[model samples]
Target chain A: MPLNITLTDYGVGNLYSIRRSLENCGAEVTVVRDMKEVLDAECVVFPGVGAFDKTMEKLQPYREDIREKLLSGTPALGICIGMQIMYNSSAEGTTPGLGVFDGDVVPLVGKVIPHMGWNQVVSDDPLMDGVGDRNFYFAHSFRGNPSEDITIGTTEYEGTEIPTFFRKANTYGTQFHPEKSSTSGMAVLRNFISFAESVL
Target chain B: MLTKRIIPCLDVKDGKVVKGINFKGLRDVGYPPELAAAYEKQGADEITFLDITASLETRQTMLDIVSETAGKLFVPLTVGGGIRSVSDMRDALNAGADKVSVNSAAVKDPSIISECAESFGRQCVVVAIDGKRVDDHWEVFTHGGTKPTGIDAVEWAKKAEDLGAGEILLTSMDADGVKTGYDIPLTAAVADEVSIPVIASGGCGSKEHIYDVFAQTNASAALAASIFHYNECTVGEVKEYLRDRGIVVR
Candidate 1:
């Protein structure tokens, strides 16, 4: 049977691309704006773009439901700002995140603000299986500063090293957009789908 | 360090890839999605699709093609041509476009830039300026380089950045199709004036030309068409050439 995935649509960011990427991974995908549907999914993918404050506002109503599902050990994956929002809070705004993980999202201290383009990421996590030392597409101004224990990958930009991938329990997060990152990115998604399948 | 990007631009007319000299005399190349996939395999950092048709009927076709291409390609995809309003930008983004480049409409009303940037983050809005050298200064051209907007390219680029545009797609009309090289002076002027990323477009004939633009100007990326479409040089070849020359590329 095809893996069932529910993508949270906060009415912000690039939802269509995430949907397409998940569907390309041979998983049955559904975009849910309702909290009930989001909580009922076999697996959850929270993909986001735009400002952190705005995304938090849009996700406020479903915050409790999403946290409940994640805390209960439901398989979850967050992409880009989606991953940033999984932390306790963000420097992008005063708005609090879902607090699923123990960390704070902060702005990247580099010459370029939006570390846009493809960059090499190094990780030994299962989600990064087969995606060894490959470049992934990234377009964001903020970087997540998660606790050391959850950090799974890092990308060196200029002189600074930023966390690019992380996982805690059943929750997974990527600072780059795996949907837009090409072959290595697809491998990440496929791995996530496999993880979801095993849990199901 | 941030790597230099090599982007392949596909000019789509009625769902087919087309190329022209200085924005005229169009010729069919191939399917947009297929060409995009090939470029991605060739190691393209990004792909740009410009809907040259710019009509209501053709817009639907362009959306379908964007959706199809976004599904298969993994690099950043930027769509330009005939995008006028926030709703239109939303449609393109919803169809899976990573960035929307505004040209003629933005020249008519500059507010559209802030509107798009405000609604979809500054990163999503790319203001494409088709410029031509007239007398001593470069002037911004619109309507696919057919009409001159009488706006100074440098000043306009600064204004766009101040108004929240994340990047500027600077295309030199005079250098286009000639294939000598990019308009280094023009690209440098805009790149120096604006803090945002500048994509140098038009007049890329050889790998050396791309290198010269990156070496001479502060452009974050370089965009090409004819060379790639006609199989003169693959994206990987250009990248290898750049990498050999000490330029960082993914």
Candidate 2:
């Protein structure tokens, strides 16, 4: 059966584009704003934008439900701000995070803020194919410093080796929005969906 | 090592691709996504779409085109032409544009560059300086090279970098459609002033011009419109030519 992917539409994300892209790749997608709709899906995507504190506040009501879903081996993929919230603490917000990963979101210092545009990803996984040593689209200021075991790929800027993608069993996250990453980004979504389905 | 980039800049009108010479005789270039895919297949380093016709009616359509092309190209994409506010930048970035270039908008408010860089990161922000020789000094142009800003081109390029711009896309309005060659002096001037990468746009007619630009100027990359559009020079051919000239390109 095709994976039932729920892209949480918490009034923060540009979910339409992400949903449409996943649907095009033959995945069953549902745009959800409520916890009831979320539980019906096997794979959950926490795609968000804006301040980390604000995002965490908005997700507060559903945090317990999300935690429950994740601990049950339901795959959860976070994008951008969503990924930052997975870490223990984020400099962007005074409030704490979900503490799913042992890391913190820190600001890009000295160099320009909001490390936008495209940069090269140092990857050794199927999620990043055909990208080679080229550039992938990025738009963020704070980045996750994942523990060694969770980091899957990285992108460097000014000397900072930021973990671009992180994976720990059923929980996966990308500081860069793969949905917005052009073609190579699509391949990542495909990989995540496949990874979720094979979870036994 | 950094690879040479082949970029195709589309002049967009009401969300459709349009092209012309010397910013005149506007002609249709078909769908933006189709043109982007063609360029990507030809091994383009990136694609830039500029909404030439800056109008309220065209804004939504341009966003749609940006979203659509971003999906098909699968490489770095930059959108420009009518960006004004952070909201505009957000709209374009959300639509899948990897980077958004601001020309006229940045001139009106110099801090917009830093503001955008702060929100989206410096790498996502590009300051496109349209330069033209005015009385022996290169001056920045606004409104698609229709009006000239009093600021000196070289000075402005450095200021843009200082303001947190990740890269500079310098276009010589005088050489834009001339197809003679790049303004090596102006390119070198800006490239010399800034530590960041400079993309040399305008006045590229042949592979030799690319070699000359790289060999003569410190430009990180060379960008041409008509030459690449008309198949006058392919990126591989240009790179191979540059390589023979002892310029490092990957």
Cα lDDT tens digits, model 2, A9-124, are: 65533455567668766789877667567666778888755567766776676666766677677888888888888888888778888777787888765344445445677878
Q: Each candidate's fnat, in order?
A: 0.50, 0.11
Check candidate 2 and list the clashing pairs: A113-B121, A114-B120, A114-B121, A115-B121, A116-B123, A116-B124, A117-B124, A183-B74
lDDT of 1 by residue, A94-157 (tens): 8889888888998787655567788888877788888855788888878898765788888988
Candidate 1: residue pairs that collide: A158-B1, A180-B74
B21-136: candidate 1 lDDT, tens digit per residue? 23212342377887788788888999999998989989999999999988778788999999989899999998889999998888888999999987888888999999999999
How well does candidate 2 score on lDDT at residue A6?
83
TM-score of each model's chain B: 0.95, 0.92
**Deviation from native of the Cα of residue A1 in model 1, angstroms:** 2.8
**What iRMS does model 1 reach?**
1.8
